[model samples]
Target: DWVNLEAHELNIPKDESTKNEAHWNCTLKNRTVKVLRRWLNERATYDKYQDRDELWLTKKATPYSSKSCNYLLTRLIEEGDVPIPEHKEITWYSIRHGVATHWANHVGPHHAKEQLRHKSVTTTMKYLHSDSEMRSTAVEQIW
Candidate 1:
């Protein structure tokens, strides 16, 4: 698959969101573009690709599944020496949830809802994590 660098966006045919939200537009910045450039070069040289349309492929050149993505993340975390507590858990959905919480905090719940393309704000709220201390500080500052 080819990336349209000039447009500075990645067109995803499908996403984890609802059915109507089929097309997900991922914005690409300069840093991401640089990494993509290197990856594209590697993809071109990789054997067994067989002219596939998929952006990500395995050593066998098949399309990467959600399972593989999760596995890869685990391996990367271990390699990067990121600490994880025994009780804590991490998954692809967790990353998405964290982003949703961040968006809700910085902008507004409605903005996060729109960005996630959820059917309702209630659904978006399920993905967010609250910070009581932050809320307390904000309330104190309001006086």
Candidate 2:
């Protein structure tokens, strides 16, 4: 299992209601590992800056404002060569919602809450939608 140890090592405060730092472990496929290693190697080729602040100021690395990130994503969708299905309304936040929902469906509520770093379980639950099929299945399990 490939663990993203970075999140676990983050010295953030945790409360009963919220987890500030979240991590996920996955079985790393060879191709994905190779790709990640390549990216890290490429990044290492550049001279190290004194600190994160200096790097941000001196290099092309700038903080991504939420609005700017969303705008850039939309532009990429519109102009990029990749074929994507037409959607009437789509926003960058939807991707986060989708990931939360998917995790909730596969791993159950408790795990999903931890993974998402949600302040409240209620907020995590909001991502999970109840459909008629799921309701029926849940009812059957109770009997």
Candidate 3:
């Protein structure tokens, strides 16, 4: 329901698809906390709906729908001049998968499952990606 700046955690509300779900606490890294703080300060300067319960608001002080979020992300990427490889696409799910993969690689699948809030490790495995480099490293370690 709220973000705890001191704890560096946010409460993620359960969506309609989540069965028997309550809120989940997602821990934020220090860098994420810093960025969020900066965003809050900056947004307050120009946002008329500062008192609104919604975390994100458009310039017109309206809540952002999924489509608007996608548009905003695309616009930001273009305006920021971020380069994308040919045939490559970036979406919110890309970031989610990246985070899930990082946890699965560095730690373990059980940990990744927790990080991703998946009910099963099998579900978490779908987000993990293994490249040639990782395969090579594993083969070398075995030999």
Candidate 4:
């Protein structure tokens, strides 16, 4: 699940000054919007502020610090008692990397670039690199 909902739940207006509109719009999802609405509704019960601006205090609302977010995630992972994957250690970032890599390999570059909001095709290409062993197998089959 996306982590930024706490800020929205606290009724914090996004800091538009630093917002990368392109990046945001590109990655925005219907699920994220729905979660944000749920958070706002939950918070509204206890919160007295009526206006959107007041509810979402630009400076005072809890900031979504990535480091803290990761720390909390680590704790949750430990608490879940889930088995670790046999092949690799799964981290929060692996999900993003997997999505990017999957898109680049399966969907092609231009579509992947748009989905990822990557500034450069070269950056997107990095994700397209399949494992060397897999590449070798692919080449053998094709040739």
> For all the candidates, what are their Cα RMSDs to the real structure?
3.0, 6.4, 2.7, 7.3
lDDT of 4: 0.59
Backbone clashes in model 4, listed as residue pairs:
11-56
Tens digits of per-residue lDDT, candidate 1, 112-136, equal 8877767699999999999787799
Highest-scoring model, TM-score:
3
Candidate 4 residues 47-74, lDDT tens each? 4434343323323355446555566666
| Cα TM-score of candidate 4 | 0.53
**lDDT leader:** 3
- Assess the local accuracy of residue 55 in candidate 3 as a C-alpha lDDT between 0 and 100: 70
**What do the candidate models score in CA lDDT, each in turn?**
0.78, 0.59, 0.80, 0.59
Q: Candidate 2 has which clashing residue pairs, if any? A: none
Superposed by TM-score, candidate 2 places the C-alpha of residue 16 at a distance from the truth, in angstroms, of 18
Could you give candidate 2's per-residue lDDT for residues 1-143 as a string of tens digits?
A: 13233332222333322335444333344665666667555655665533332212223466555676677778887788556666644567777677777777777877777666776879988887655776799899997
In candidate 3, stretches whose alpha carbon ends up further than 4 angstroms from where it belongs are 14-20, 41-47
Which of candidates 3 and 4 is the stronger one according to lDDT? 3
Q: What lDDT is reached at residue 134 by model 4? A: 61
Model 3 lDDT-worst window of ten: 15-24
